[model samples]
Target: MASIKAQAHHQRVRIRGYDVDIRTYGAGARNVVLVHGIGASGRYFSRLVDLLAQTCTVHTLEMPGFGSAPKPSHSLDMAGFAAVNCDALRAAGIGPAQWVGHSMGCQVVTEMALLAPDLVTSVVLLSPTINRGERNAVLQGLRLAQDCLREPPAVNWMLLTDYLRAGPRWYLRTMPKMVRHRLEQRIGGVEVPVTLIRGGRDPIVPARWLQELAAARPGAVAVELPGQPHVCMFTEPARTAALLREAASGQ
Candidate 1:
């Protein structure tokens, strides 16, 4: 992938009564949408965006209640979150493209694909969350802490600061929907191709969970990058970008 030479286009558009910030990178024919997790902003995909911009137009969506976006009047469930993103993309004059998401963002994209299949060409989920076997928030938090030990300081710092930026009120209010979302069941509804990528050492999404996720769809493919933790997109951008490229290429 070529280094990102083009400047990104940053703008805020209204979506469901809230101003949603979205960044567009490159002017390539193919469209690639990047969705951050619950606590993270679209900025988390800076490196991956640079890589994907080489051959695809990358769109980073900063969901309402996260990043610099203002919180909504009330918490939105998974479907509501997807609807907001879909509406934002449409309002921005962007059409269907490859969808890439990290952690809770995976749930969001999966929901989007289900809600607007015509708007999603494919999907790539990184470190997807709320493993069916371990859906409780407390246990997942403990597992995330354990996984953090293996992550680099910069990765943990980014995660911590992003979580702080999101604030407890919003995170706590929105987390239940993420945990309760039937992502495993919902994945089956996505007719477009799906690719599931997990850090080999990611505690939040284990091997069995990845397998089950892949098994949910007849054409889904699961990839594991050993020794990488939950935020591999930050710590291992090259590998993550390469996998994303392959997924976007439909390889």
Candidate 2:
């Protein structure tokens, strides 16, 4: 949870046209949007927004089926998520802004860049998951399914209380769609400047994938946090904010 001071400085905006719930902070000319990963919400970027607000106007978006927004009625996939984000950005009057996404948010950012390249100035991907490969990808999906099945309802309650708040059935039904999403092709099509941040200790996404993405992009840089994990954005908001500032400034 973010401090009271941080939340006080941020403004909540509802964009009905896009069906988005957005948090806006600071008054800087440079605008930046933060997108959280699966089973998370805009609240995850509270600290990062606090840090970046000094030099950038930060916007954090809660997807249709997450955070305070209503659960999506239609079948939701990466593309659907991207479209909603795009509509939200437009409704919020954000144009050609720097986009920062973490984990599953990275995938959404990729899809947005592909879907509306002209609207994106640059992208910062945190712990992006790409190229799952044939064998390992299937195994990972199966493992996630098994874990979902084997874990006690209490464990699920403890870990995903926020998600449950959005809607248990919605979360359960959307879980499989997220696991099956593949963004390799869309990621390869990105032409804007990209900076990838990876937690060295993150087990979910390997360093090899980060390296590959960096190699593929025309102007992509990958940075690995020395002793961080999947939640590095929350665990290391200051460091992540610095990287985001650098990328936003075109450094």
Model 2 per-residue lDDT tens digits across residues 1-251: 34533553433344443367777777788888888766668765666777878777778888877777766557568777888889778766787788888877998898898888878888999988644652254565553454345434543453366666667676666666666777555677887788999877766667887887777775688899877666677668899988887887683
Model 1: CA > 4 A from native: 1-6
- Among all windows of 10 consecutive residues in model 2, the one with the lowest summed lDDT is 9-18
Residue pairs with backbone overlap in model 2: none
The predictions' CA RMSDs to the true structure, in order, are 2.0, 4.5
TM-score of 2: 0.82
How well is each residue in 1-251 modelled by candidate 1, as lDDT tens digits? 22452477788989659777888889889998989998888766877877777778888988998988888888888888899999999889887888888999999999998888888888999999889999998998899889889988877787799889889999999989899998889899888889999888898899999999999887998999988888878778888888877787783
Best by TM-score: 1
TM-score of 1: 0.95
Model 2 CA lDDT for position 24? 77
TM, every model: 0.95, 0.82
lDDT of 1 at 122: 85
